[model samples]
Target chain A: GQQVQQSPASLVLQEGENAELQCNFSSTATRLQWFYQRPGGSLVSLLSNPSGTKHTGRLTSTTVTKERRGSLHISSSQITDSGTYLCAMERSSSFSKLVFGQGTSLSVVP
Target chain B: SVLLYQKPNRDICQSGTSLKIQCVADSQVVSMFWYQQFQEQSLMLMATANEGSEATYESGFTKDKFPISRPNLTFSTLTVNNARPGDSSIYFCSSSLGGETLYFGSGTRLTVL
Candidate 1:
């Protein structure tokens, strides 16, 4: 079974619109991280939310450890924000072992 | 913050041939992870390399297919054994410096013809 899971395999939004991606884990994770990869490009770390809420630029990440779920919200998305967002989780014992979600592909049209 | 460097941004190899990918971290890391991502697809965890021990591979992946070596804390290598067209993908090396976030290398794109 996959330890981490993501929702909305694909999404399309208009420019200046907001988009939300969801992630759920089956195991108790002590570590959680989110990443973004542009089309045909490498991944960049967006946020590392292990337990609570965090925000950076137009991105926000909220993690509820008790519910084993997390969400990434994009405010007033732009065309540059179009990419695949990945969520990863790791158990307490496997500090370095990260299980990744399939990711959500978001496309923002201008 | 730990920065990871990977060599040979891209490579084209023939079937049945093999290739090695290297990863070097700026700081000492206890473990290194290898991932593979197909075109427009999600990353798949290949194996976990720990210093002074054999790498642990995930299910459906065998050590013979993807051999790994971790000589020290900052360096590791992953070899694609007997490459096939199906193996063509982007390989990324990452390290976790005891943090919630794992720092990733730029990734090596491999094309097996």
Candidate 2:
């Protein structure tokens, strides 16, 4: 069984629309990070915030540790934002491996 | 932030044969990990490459099947012995600075036929 799960397995939006991706974890998490999977199967780190609201460019991540859930907001989306977004959680912050969610596929159209 | 470089972006091998994938970090990192992902699936952690010591294996993974070697802080290798078609997947080498963000290599796409 997967320890982490993501919502909206797939999503489609207009170029200017915003998207809200959700994540839920079954175990205690000391760190939460968002990543974008490249077309070639590589991954690019977007944001890493264990809790509270953190913003970087067009991406914002908010993790509620007590609730065991998190959300990612993408504002003013662009076509280039089309890809699979994954949310991963680490049981501990000190050099621990991450358990990843299934991922949210975002397709931004013009 | 640390940058990782993986050699042989892609590899195609025959069944019963073996191959080695290498990962090098631009800067020294305390830990490195190997991950495997089937097509359209999420990534799964394989093992931890410990510097100056034998690698640690995760569940369903063993050192005999995927021998990992980390001679130093910046370099590590994962070798697949007697590969099979079922072993085909994308292998990623990753490292972190002991905190927030994790860095990943471009990844090695392995196909066994």
Candidate 3:
């Protein structure tokens, strides 16, 4: 079974609109992290939320440990925000071994 | 954040040939791991390259086919032996500074003909 699952396989938004991405994982996951991959294939770490809600600029990450789910909220979307948003779950005792979701492809247009 | 540089950003090779991809981290990191992602697919962890020890491979991956060598904290090399078309994919090397946040490399695009 897949360790991590993301919803809304794809999303389209206009500039200045908001976007939300969801992620669900198994109970075995110790931590959850969000990443953005450039069209060229480079990955950038967005945020890591274990529980509660976190805010970063126009981005917000909320994680519910009890339900084993998390969500990323992007406010005021911009053209440069168009890319693949990925959620990863960290497992294992040592090292940050991650299991990734299929990802949500987001396209922001003017 | 640690910056990772992968050699030969992209490569194409014939079937049955072998190739190696190297990862170098700007700063020393505690752990470095390898991941494989097919076109339009999620990234899958392949193995954990440990310094001065054999890499720990995940299920469906073997050291014989994808051998990894981590000689030091900031350097690791992954070699693909007996390459096949199915082996073509983007390979990423990631590192962590003993924290939950894991940084990734730009990735090496491989094409096996």
Candidate 4:
């Protein structure tokens, strides 16, 4: 069974529109992190939210640990923001072994 | 924040050969992680490397197939032995400062034919 799951496998939005990505897990997580990656590129950490809400630049992440769910909101989508958004979680007892979701592919069009 | 440098950005090798990828962090880190990601798929944790100890591999991964070495706090290496076409994937090395935020390397793209 997959421990982490993401909704809306893919999304598309205009340059100025907003996008929301959802992530759900099956177990209690001590840590949750969001990452962004361009096609054929490396990953960049966006936000780390185990619980509650966190904001950075135009990105925001909210995680409800008890509910085992998290959401990432991207404001004012830009072409540079077009990439794959990945959500990963670590079990409360584990050391940093992250279980990643399938990820939501977002494309920002001009 | 820590910076990780991975070498051999892309490589293509014949089946049955071996390949080695190296990752060097700008500063000392407590642990480093290895992940494999296939095309259109999510990242899968391969193993965890800690300095001065045997690497801890995840389920479905073994030292015989994917050997890792972390001799120091700032460097680690992952090697694929007897490579197969199925082993083709992007391998990334990541490390964390406090186990909350993770920094990733550029990734090594391997192709076995």
Among these predictions, the greatest lDDT belongs to 4
TM-score of chain B of each: 0.98, 0.98, 0.98, 0.98
- Candidate 3, residue B106: the lDDT equals 90
lDDT of 4 at A106: 98
lDDT of 1 by residue, B28-78 (tens): 999999999988777888999999999999887889999999999999999
| DockQ, model 4, C-alpha based | 0.76
lDDT of 4 at B105: 98
Go through the candidates in order and give each one's C-alpha lDDT.
Answer: 0.89, 0.91, 0.90, 0.92
Off by over 4 Å in 4: A93-95
Q: For candidate 2, what is the DockQ-based docking class?
A: medium
Model 4, B4-112: lDDT tens digits are 9999999999999999999999999999999999998999999999999999998989999999999999999999999999999999999988756789999999999
Reference interface contacts recovered per candidate: 0.47, 0.72, 0.83, 0.72
Tell me the deviation in Å of residue A75 in model 4: 1.2
- Distance (Å) between predicted and true CA of B41, model 4? 0.7
A7-74, model 1: which lDDT tens digit per residue? Answer: 99999999999988999999788767899988667778889887888999999999999899999999
Q: Which docking class does model 4 fall in? A: medium
Following a full C-alpha superposition, what root-mean-square deviation does model 4 have from the true structure? 1.2
DockQ scores for all the models shown? 0.58, 0.75, 0.78, 0.76
Q: Give per-residue lDDT, candidate 1, residue B34.
A: 92
Ranking by DockQ: 3, 4, 2, 1
What are the models' TM-scores?
A: 0.90, 0.97, 0.97, 0.97
